[model samples]
Target chain A: MYQDWIWGLVGGGLIGIAAALYLLVNGRILGASGILGGLVDGTERAHSKERLAFLAGLVLVPVSVVPFYSSVDTHLTPNLAVVIFAGLLVGVGTRLANGCTSGHGVCGISRLAPRGMVATVFYLLGGGASLLLFKHVLGVI
Target chain B: MRALFAFIAGGTFGTGLVVSGMTDTTKVQGWLDIFGDWDPTLAFVLGGAVVPMFFAWRYTDGRLPRLGGKFPAPPEPKLDHNLVLGSLIFGLGWGLAGLCPGPAIASLSYGGFGGGVFLIAMIAGMLAAPPARRWLDAVAGSS
Candidate 1:
């Protein structure tokens, strides 16, 4: 039950299926950031209802399902400043780049898109380097 | 309609996030921490997602979406500064918090205080990004 990688694969398969369905049915890339960021930035008002529906499912399903299995613990950082700073960077960065893990990491790479591949490599490098700086050096993580 | 399909996809994605342990910040941080006691779970998750999507892309070659609109065109091949710089910044945030957009949103169901704070800050940042992006485009074009 605790075999994390196996479950990771299963769950990932589900995610892929989700993406696949979105493309096949809706004729759009199922990027979480784009779906939500469009609303946040007001660039997607034309599809706001659809976007909101997507988000509602994204938020509510987890809320509804997690209780049936077990309560989740995110183990987010206790430090308030770190949380805020990290959130800000993720928001700004994802919006500016027009993608995130869902868009660039999942959908982009699967299609072998160059932009997605490049973004993934850089972000991985950035993440690793950040860990080295903060976790290894400063012991912050 | 399109909205119904979108909702189903979102729900499935959310379920996947929960089941895959993607919502667990420690798991994400562990995956990022190469020098430390690194976790390799995220690799499986990523690879698993890509495999099906690979076929999905091929299947869409000449097919129209069942609902209405055309599929998303292939992404532009050009690599831009915004793409790289923004990704790097995003990565820094990911490494710092071990949470990206999908999981960050999903985790809100149970992420408690810290999660709430993160969401608010993220939205604020999203709001600030547009003007900054326009400024960047202007500066780049002029240079």
Candidate 2:
């Protein structure tokens, strides 16, 4: 069930459809960080209701399916400090960059937008470098 | 209503994350670990998602949305400090935790305490971003 490449494609197809649906009906790019950041930073008050509605689905669907999937395992690190630090960095950094995997990686890149493409490059570089330093050189992660 | 659409869309996205095995942090980390044992599962996922969206973007050309809202403007191509620096920072975090916003939220439905803690810290970081961004823009002269 897990690690099946076929499932990955199916899932990815579903994600694409979701984004397409959001765009066609809601007329907007579907970016998770942007949606949540707006609510957190108070910059999206005008569409808070809409944002909440979207988030409600994002959060609830997973919860609802938990009973069926039994439980979801993320395999995140046990080191709380590392987790906190990483979370903080993700939160701040994504907001600064204006998108994440959903926005820049999936949506923006699909459109072949220069900005999303560039952003994707930097992020990949960053991820590669971080892994080298921590996972290899330092062996911390 | 548009909210209903958002809900459905969001739900579909969540379902995709669960079904695609994206919610699994190990696979995500594996993808990021290009130096070590790399997994190509996510690449397919990305490819599959992009194909449909590519058409979806084309569908939006010179058209109005059914829900009566403006499509998000294409991002400007001009590079800026925030875009580079922030993306780097995000990448660093992503490598460290392998949890981006989508999985982070989706995980909340049946995640462990560790995931919960990460979410809280992430929220705090988000709240601090505006001021931090202002500081960054000031330091960098707004690119």
Candidate 3:
């Protein structure tokens, strides 16, 4: 059986390499939310084509892999209402904060930027607390 | 050339999300569920990603990017109410759904109807952010 952590390490390494390549070549942070968010808000119109191209690649590559690794699991919540609420929170919050897991957690912390570190800590804390409330306190998740 | 490289970078990143199981909500919730059957895979993923990125950051020190464009300016290091509040909200949402932007988009290929709904809502929320921010700023300024 494939070890979960092993897969994580390998996959994470690829993610880092991708981020590195993006930085080295594009002079931009490989932040998924920031890229997509920019397009949504029309704040990145100048680089809209590039952003679209990146997103196209992001979606296409994974789809191509589905044929071989058909067991890929997304594990999304089944409740539509909850899912919608969660989506809204993520969208608004990430944009308001100007980062997300990729932008802040991966790229930001790697650079030892205080903003990244602080944001990461807060988000983790928030996530942990929410899990406690939802899973333990309310028993609703 | 820029578009091509962007595509390549995104493709590689998507593969990483899939390979690392970051696309799976169960694993994500497990990581957050400290009181339950917590899994450490996500931690490993973060650790593994940081290794190469550390070198990448170092390599860029006092140097221009190979593509001849100015590197993005570093964000201000100040701590503020908005930063903390925004992150807290985001974290709550992340824990609730067990999916973030990267995994959400990458999983769309096979994520079915639910994925489509989440993506549309997420985009709508993103579109609403600027107006919300402006409102918040106005409120903060008044107070």
Alpha-carbon local distance difference test for all models: 0.87, 0.86, 0.86
Q: B121 in model 1: Cα distance from truth in Å?
A: 1.0
RMSD of each: 1.7, 1.9, 1.6
TM-score of chain B of each: 0.93, 0.93, 0.92
Model 3 C-alpha lDDT per residue in residues A1-141, reported as the tens digit of each score: 149889899999999999999998888899988999998787888778778888988899977764445877777878999889888888888888888999999999999999889989988887888789888898878
lDDT of 1 by residue, B1-143 (tens): 88888898899999999999889888888888888888888888999898889999999988898997788888779899889988998899889988888888877778999998998888887887888789888988999
lDDT of model 2 at position A72: 63
Q: Write the per-residue lDDT of candidate 2 for residues B12-83, one digit (tens) a residue.
A: 899899888888877887887889987778788888889899999998899989989688888668788888
What lDDT does model 2 reach? 0.86
Clash pairs for candidate 1: none
After the best TM-score superposition of candidate 3, give how far the Cα of residue B129 lies from its true spot, in angstroms.
1.4
Give each candidate's interface RMSD in Å. Answer: 1.3, 1.5, 1.3
Judged by DockQ, which candidate is best? 1
Off by over 4 Å in 1: A66-68, B138-143
For candidate 3, lDDT tens digit of each residue in B1-143?
A: 88999999999999999988888887888887777777878788888888898899999989988877888888888877667877888888888888889989998888989888888888887887888888878887889
Better structure of 1 and 2 per DockQ? 1
Candidate 1 chain A: worst 10 consecutive residues by lDDT?
A63-72
